[model samples]
Target: MVGSGFQRLRKSPWEILSSAIFSSILVVSSQLALAMVPHFFPSFSLVSMLPIAGVVFVATVVIGRWCRRLLGVPASAPAFVLFNVFFLWGVYICIIRQAVPSLLDAILNAECALLLFGLYRIFSSDPGMVSYDSSRSTEASCNGFSDFSQCENSSLFPRVRYCTSCKTNIRGFDHHCPALGNCIGQKNHRLFMVLLTGFVIAESSYTMCSTRYITRFLNTSRVGLEANLSLNMVISTMLFSILQVLWQVVFLMWHLYCICFNIKTEEWINWRKYPEFQLNIPAPAQQGSAFSEIRFFNPYDKGFVGNIKEFLKPKH
Candidate 1:
């Protein structure tokens, strides 16, 4: 299923599992962490796991509802929590256990930090909202687009749209992202690309490091209660990383194509509604043809290089 917002991204089973794990870990004490238990002692992982799961489920539901009521940024908190969980686990569990080498770990952690920073920028930055002018309200009303900030002298902001979720008019509006709790628009679209690329890189590195560690552990160690518990957690992390990397990479490619074509995700979906895409350019004429056909054209297309340059240097 797509995420519960305008992102239109997949909600993989691994994502659900990660959210559950994060929620459970958050509600449960640090003592619930398998790492806290001494290796020499009898493992209490089995004993502690069930209660943690149950308590976390209840806590997650309550917290989710509370956040929705107060923040109005659906799924943002969970996504933030999941990112922190991965970083914490990578440092505390994977790095400490030598799953990743020092040099490689340093690079991976830097990428993780970059991803976090990009997400922060997306969440905090203005998305090129078109300021409403009461002076132009009469003109807007006359234009039959009073609800939007696009009328009369606002020919420059052709793709402007009123986001119901944000209660504002966004310039070059693409979509609302529940994960980042922000709208993807002219100002932050490039940042979104950077974030997506960083995510794919970081996730791929994490998956590789996790796979190396898991393989090494399984080959070298004997099966024991404590060992089994640790292995299970690592395995789960690897699985989540794999699933997320696969999904996000595909999403990244799709966005790249849109960028190349100078087409917003929203515009692509509702092309017929936009006058910019209504260029009825005629097809080639034939010698005995009774009629010529018109093909749809994107007026905003400035060729691939020009489109990329425009995206990188947006008019903000």
Candidate 2:
């Protein structure tokens, strides 16, 4: 069942072609920009790279739109390409240009590789998909609540949700990540967290390194800095890195909080719907009220240490 579901996730020919085209443009454009830097700037200022970057950006946008509208490629796939583009630019223009220590460069590259691997694993691995078992009655699957059988999605087991996007029931369902092009659930949740944490660290470091580069090498004079394209390019990278770091950090923190309490994001958002939550919370509950005196009771929460243990424990 998992295999069949995974097979469904496979990309169409058009999608593969679209990805190849997108990647090719990014690689060729960046390399062309780098090549032009030596001849145009002589001293190799980042200013020379901007024109190509703009062109590449426009080209990718057009291709993305065309692919989505015509070939029907998933919009989320472009995010992976965008990430690589940023990482490549950061490494080449900032770290290399600034001549950061080899140790730092190696570390950054290693993190990038690991992040790519983690993403691949998340994309390819099953996220604890729950297969339908006709032999098991709704009473058994729904914890003796046969009434739940009347529900449209009665086949789902406890804590399992039907993902419309993936067309499968995800066990310990968290949320569907369009960017990852997969559902995050029991199996891949750990990998998702690791990837998020790594990206937050890597992007933050990239921002720092780029800032250091601008400060160290660029002219400090007000006039010199004013309208400086090279400075602008580096600054743009810094801003991009900062933006990524900000969102990822916030997202990571939220996930960490949920993990500490042994709750899934889906459950956190839709707690009232679950009988466990309704039973735990006192009577006369205001529906969908954000503020309540009664603390949410999570049956799965086994204290901080225990929750962490549960999260980290290997899954079969």
Candidate 3:
């Protein structure tokens, strides 16, 4: 079943009993952690956890709603709460209690929550879907369409191609993210970029805060509960921080380059694979020449400042 992820009881009864025993042992070990090693540093209060906890709950609920609509799967809510919100919350809690000061964690996580809400905006909005007639008119020149083809509509919408997967014409269609269960398109591309930027900022803060604790625990001469817990939290948070920071930084840079050129990932890929592919809006049909002559040059190139303005400005 789709949501019945782990219901199978295939383990033998002996295996089950052994697993239970082992779990009990692990629990006892964890409880004894502070006792066995008094030097270990982390001490938490419900107060510290509260702010981040509230953020996590709000993120889970908001993203759950947006993600379900994007993916068209209402049944994913349980997993969304379990993995996206609480799982991350658990990791975050480790950092708040063991690695970073609670006040700092709360501040950083609040910013992270705002970014998540921005991402939810991207996920929930349409990706600038163009009408079929609008796309079809690209063959002719009319109004601002300088391309050879005639354009009957002067309303001037982005020239879009048909998307077989979506069964619609999409303006500036990027590609479908299976994880998001939605296509990245013109409308939300900028917001998506900002979301990635947010993750980078948040993860960087987490890694930095974790580093001091990790250094102290690793350097300690004595081995005890605090060292072990600190080690676990530091290692876990740092690995992801390194990965996310690198990936998001690179991804954001590449996308910015694309934005400067007014292209999407899908368009870039197509242009690379196919020699005849065009990168910009259709060229003016001109007094004589067809729009195809300068294939690499972007028709939408409004210089860096203009592009930035258009990109940052909100659209209806």
Candidate 4:
């Protein structure tokens, strides 16, 4: 007998349960950490989490709205953003106190959210095929034709091209993401990069501050009422300063290389792009490349040694 008025769930019950369980665990762990940790550790604060929470909530809402739009549903970005902000602020106050580590954790959490969102987008998208349709060309007489003729026709899934894992077409293709998920093609590319940049800045700043604090802590000496700054602090500070300088120089060089070459992270994974996309752009990849064109670099790529070589490679 056919069951009337019964609809099959689009998402599995176990999947929903797992998601809820994971979210609960994240909240509980964060709350416990905040409660147990000393207030001195900056990560225990509401202020530290605010920015990250805001970014995560906003990005999630934006992606949801985008999905709805694609499904022919009406949605407003402003309303979603506003709602997310309010909810995020509430979570910030309820979960953690203002502290540096807390702030860093918030940023990390936001990055995780973005990564998950990107992954979801990649899986949900349709796989598009690459093909050529010369019949549609209105040009009567083509004085010139090149090897690029095969790229004349757009892929069936115009937003996505090569999927690295499956080595096939990706639906709703945005771009490839290594940090969050596999790729950020069509759907979640914008949100992924936006959150990623924010995460990088937040993480870097936190690391810098923590290193300084650790140096100061190590340098402190137990002295009588007349306490003087120890030489150890001075040495630690000098070492940290040099390390920081070197880190920044390396980072800036890599950024410059990406900008000049017009390469996206996805290109590294699959070496695919639209026929119209060009590799000779002057602006940095992060700053100039469209959301769909940017790619994420793998951090575990030969421990900075290989990275330097890759960054210095000429754009061809």
Candidate 5:
């Protein structure tokens, strides 16, 4: 499935050609900017980076636009502007300049590209929404019903709650991610965490591989720093990597916690908001098992390994 999806995404010859052209341009422009410090600039200044930034921006836009059109990922996959700046810095300092060993750089770039493709897959896949008429039935349609199987979206085994923002009874709706322009739900939450995990791995290795030079250049004397454009490049890239790693670690860990406990982000947030939500079980005598006033209780929570399996299971 993954291979076929990637093939479909890259089926366009024009897209492949355009991406190759922009990637080549990115490599050349970044290398030229990095080379400026060694030969052209004895004391490079911030003002000198304007030309480099302009060139990188053009290349980024071209590639970013192509990715958006092909993969349905946002033009800026990450909404954070800092990520983009750091990406450019990373390219200029390490990737284009070949800061790491040739073989190591190739390996890292390949891994990073695969992680990026994974993100595109998660973003583009439909996340268990029942929008079509054929997929929904009157009997299966849940109107905030207690028995989740009654919902058309059986992918959401338990959750079928009204989403005030979306104005629909969403099944297992975790939350809407504006960055991806999609809802992270029962079907895609696992994929979302996997994507986050991939970024964590990619960023960690990238940082580890380049940390030595980045730190050395950052610690250089002011005059030496000015003479070495890589110093600025490395510093910015390091900062960006650090920020991303920290954020991804915390974010992924939190989601892991949620998965372990068999809870959704949306439920965790509003669990306390409604202490005594009514459950319609169609029988007042069977209230204890079917519907109870068990505050903050997550019915989906199995055991530790059990919940983990639930999370790892293939999304419907």
Candidate 6:
């Protein structure tokens, strides 16, 4: 049943629309968020904003459009970067001003970073034009002959096929990334993972650092530093927390689906098979167990949830 639903989603127009809308929101919101950074952090010189904002904007536009063109999908790397930077900036402000961030700030920052990282993974590692080569080596034996089967001795390197879009025989070809506007074959996969890891680390560090400040605020009885618990503050924090959790769940499921089925984002997006071969191809291999795959810096890992248990487990 789950497989059937996934197959349906693969072909759905709604997914494309959702991807586009989400990407646009990410682009616009990221720009707005970047703009707000200056207002929030008055101490920072305007020059600092230009470099970060410029890199973020260019990366966002390129990635977003690339995803759309390659997979008929859209994503907002800019928004993810914006939220992360600003959220950290907010924490930095709280720390600088009061020497401690409130519990509210810490909670908000941590949650925001987690949410942003999840979104970034979903968009960034979207497997724009990548797919498995069913005809190459896993032929005959692994073709969809049985349910819940595995491929045996599949060829890692196969003959190249010309990509209509790129007009080149891509080596170690996984798929083309519209976001990066390049093929994410073997050579570039590591780079993509590195980009994601950096973003996650930066966002998480900012959140945790701010959280320390928040704890300090909680411990103090300083005259004006106590949280006022105003209606607006309470409501915003609550809503943000709820949204963060919800997004986290969505991300978790998506990651699990990808890992279990071994489907690349690109393959999932542009899944197609020659008419003669469609019925014979078996489903792709599922990777490692969910628990094992989620660890930090796993070569094949795509999102933070793969290591959720490790992340959530209390440190000794």
Candidate achieving the largest TM-score: 2
lDDT of all predictions, in order shown?
A: 0.63, 0.64, 0.53, 0.39, 0.56, 0.42
Q: Candidate 1, clashing residue pairs?
A: none
Model 6: what TM-score? 0.34
Please report the TM-score between candidate 2 and the true structure: 0.70
Give the per-residue lDDT digits (tens) of candidate 5, residues 1-316. 1111111122266654554454444444444444443244435553464445445545655665665567543233333332343464356444334446667677777767777676667757656654423233433565544334344454544465445433444456777765554667767777787777877777776666656555554475445645355555554354445556876799888888988988878778877533233233344664545643444556577999999997887766
By lDDT, highest first, what's the ranking? 2, 1, 5, 3, 6, 4
Indicate whether candidate 3 or candidate 4 has the larger lDDT. Answer: 3
> What are the models' TM-scores?
0.69, 0.70, 0.57, 0.31, 0.58, 0.34
Model 6: how large is the Cα RMSD against the reference?
Answer: 16.2
* Model 4 worst lDDT window (10 residues): 138-147
Candidate 4, residue 111: the lDDT equals 50
lDDT-better candidate, 3 vs 5: 5
Instruction: Report the C-alpha lDDT of model 1 over 1-316, residue by residue, as the tens digit.
Output: 2222232234578665655555444434322342233232334443344344344444555765575457433244535544554644554354334866788878877877776667667767787776644554545553766435345544545788767677667788998776676788988888888888887787778767767776787679758876666665554444445555667888999999999999888778867666656666444565556555544668889999999898888465
Return the lDDT, model 4, position 73: 47
lDDT of 3 at 208: 74
Candidate number with the higher TM-score (4 or 5): 5
Residue range 1-316, candidate 4, lDDT tens digits: 2212112124466654544444444333333333222222334343454344344434544554455556544332222222332333333333321323665657645654663454455444332322322442412222222212223443332334545443434433435433233444433434444444543453344345444444454366444522222222222222322333444556445444443453444444444344434343345666765544333433224444564454444322
Q: What is the lDDT of residue 214 in candidate 6?
A: 42
